[model samples]
Target: MSVDGDPVSETPTIKEGTWEAIALASAVMLIVWMFIAAGWIILAGEIELAQKRTAVAAAFVTAGAAVVTFCTVIWRGKINERQTNTARDQLRATEEANWAKLLQDGAALVFDSQTGKQSAGLASLEAVVQTQHRLFAKQAMNLIADYLEQVHPTDHRSPLAIAAIDALGSGHSLGFQAARSLKFEGPNKDNKRFAPRSIWVPILGVRLVRYYGGRMDTQYPHFNEACRHSTFEKVYFSKASIKDMSDFESCFFRNCKIEEIGYMIQENTFQSCDFSGAVNFGIESIDDMPDLRPRNNFYWSDRPPIGVTEIDWASRIISVPSQFSNVFAGERLMTKEGRDFIADEVLNLQRHSN
Candidate 1:
């Protein structure tokens, strides 16, 4: 007997009891038919015996077919389930591989010091601006800048640096905006602070140093008024250029009591700042002076008689313990020499308004 809706097995396994019963039923049916025929030969009437034998044979075949069908259904269902599980496993594996590749690419972009790859990495990071993976973006930008600075000296001044500077200024998560100002100086020599030679982010260029009057020899509270408005103390440079010291104009001394001005040629600006406690500045120009006048209103100097005049011009001079002179030799708000320079500048500023 064959299973319904399934191909017949080539070497079908017959159950022992069922096979024996089938053989017995076949023999019984054959004997019944033969007996009926013999009776027919003898009496010519045996239709009931033949009908019963045929019905029993049909019932046995149907029972065998049902058993075969049930077994085939169970086997086919298991095979389909196994195939489904295999397909699901393959899909999961592919997803994992893709994710791993992406992470690898990200790390390479961050750590590798190649220009093209660095740019590509940054571009990729920009594409995912809304993503939570901001740490990677910041690290990549830092590394890219470092790499460019290492190779091309002018690259530090390139627009790429400006882009990064803008990004950092944006107060975004992908930019290094929150890190505190740190000055990593070289190893200490002669009681100076020791800092390993490494990357360091300064507080506010040189202006902060000026406002604080460098490192204090004595802990004096001689503050600068400029310190009061240093809202962007943590902001780097504030659009400062390599030519002009933007921080210089922005710096004011708060609660300051310094007596002398200090200057440092940092970046592009000459920082004219006051020093508190003991330190005072004297003009030590690289060029031999023709005439020297104090830019600030007051200066201190041991060499006196040339007290804080409206202006003083000398080949070389120091502002230390300088005498105070109330004798105004120039305009109330202008020095005798700076009048022309300031006049034209102030006029130009108000010219457009009127």
Candidate 2:
């Protein structure tokens, strides 16, 4: 039979078949000898003549069987050992391939942002979320979005749901960026905003990631083509996890201004998503200023049984959008009150009996 791709290894089946055929051949030869001795094939004079004729045929058959048995057994054993040793190598190659694809896509996003090929990279990242591979599907897609947010800072990006669905891939910290970018827009003429595209290039590009089981870590053009049509639109973050983020300090939202976002994260963990100078903030008046604060010194950690796995305030100074107004509203908020507020934000998401 044939298969779509090259068989990863082939010795096990050959080895088993060789052993079976060897045993069958030995049994056949023994049966033939016993029949000859018992005169089953010949009578008197004819027996000697028949034996003479059959002896050469039997010799050839036995030799052929021995050659097949010996060759398959020996060759199969060697090939099987080689295959076993190469298994780890195969896994490593797979991982390297995944990483390469990821870097390629990331680079493309950066280039696209600089060249104005797309307003956002969320659609490109979302394209890979449908992959069947579970290992890094979420991580890779989310990271692409993260890289995009870092590279491009504007309001004309895709909605956050693109990342939300991707985050559902594995719930890693990386996926939180896209989740945090989540926002809702009513179906309108704004296909450039959050809906599907009129041109199928982006969709087709994303569809390729799905074909590779979501492990298209090296396909740059795949992402660049997908988000090529995106114009700077609203980016929202919703239902995020701190444990899903990596290099939290290095990450930024750039110049985008997020709106109408409902995000809940675990407390006392490092901040999974950062919206510092990276986001546009678009604060035109003091009213918006009331809700803005400088965020610093944050990290991510999984919650202990007694704690929660999340992005939390590493220091009292790292205030978030939700807590900005409460911490710095005109006059300085009391130290005790601020600490309590920060503590409350960390502990208030929900009470789980761990």
Candidate 3:
């Protein structure tokens, strides 16, 4: 009976057993004939002739044996090569499984309730990043970014928070398909290190859509702290107030609302950004700013920000109280009304060279 899933032979049953029987009978007949020939060569009257014929037979048999030996060596070599390749493939598969297991175990640690376990989990996730697995890297980064998203708004500098920040920065080493934005939702006294999310998130360049448009670096409006070497690109500072913030170098303030900033804006690059969106973009005088000079212009010697559109001046309140101190693009300010409106607010920001 044929087994399940096994193929049945289609050849006639009479032909199958007959072929093997015929081959066995043929071999038996050949052996009998060989024995008879050996008797004739050894015991017949022409002994000299028999000796010569035996030598000839031996020569032919030796040649045949050489050919068979060569073929056998070639066949064995091919078998070895195929086996080696199969082994290598198996080893690679096993290694990849180990890496996947390591990643899974480490990611689980990050969600544990204990702070120490969470820290260990973060470390494991970072280790996964080192493995250079694309999916793992993305997941690791998302975990840290999510953890940071949980931070409260009191300017938390905790060891764990610090680790999370560093993890995100390191996780995006490859820099493709990144979870770019982090939101600092609000402050909490209970978990002091958890968040001062609103204030510091903006300068970090992650757009806070609730506060700004994209990543709100720091969303809290009413803190008088000094900020340095931060970048704000395509940013909208709608309901925020900054004081004593200095050295905002090479930054792009796009569609920003400069509502009532302190006079200490110094050594900062605010080029290539649009301030046209503000209903009342107001600033205190830059007379206290040490870098203010009649010789230099804010919009001069600078390329426009990465995504700046053609700026319109007439719509907002434009007034240049200091003509020589035009910080915006010099001749590009086309409209009289736009210029008047922009100048009005910017003049308040203009510095006295005295």
Best by TM-score: 3
lDDT (C-alpha) at residue 185 in model 1? 22
What does each candidate score in C-alpha RMSD? Answer: 21.9, 17.8, 14.5
Model 1 lDDT tens row, 59-99? 65566555555555555555576688689669756744544
lDDT of 2 by residue, 257-349 (tens): 221111211111222223322222122332322222222221112211112222222332234333333335553223444445545655543
1 against 3, candidate with superior lDDT: 3
* Model 3 bad stretches (over 4 Å): 1-78, 135-138, 150-159, 175-183, 187-354
Report the backbone clash tally of model 2: 40
lDDT of each: 0.35, 0.36, 0.45
Q: What are the TM-scores, per candidate, against the unseen true structure?
A: 0.27, 0.27, 0.40
Consecutive 10-residue window with the lowest summed lDDT within model 2: 209-218
TM-score of 3: 0.40
Please write out the lDDT profile of model 3 over residues 139-200, one tens digit for every residue.
Answer: 66666656666543333356777677566556544452235454343333233222223334
Candidate 3, residue 221: how far the Cα is off, in Å: 25
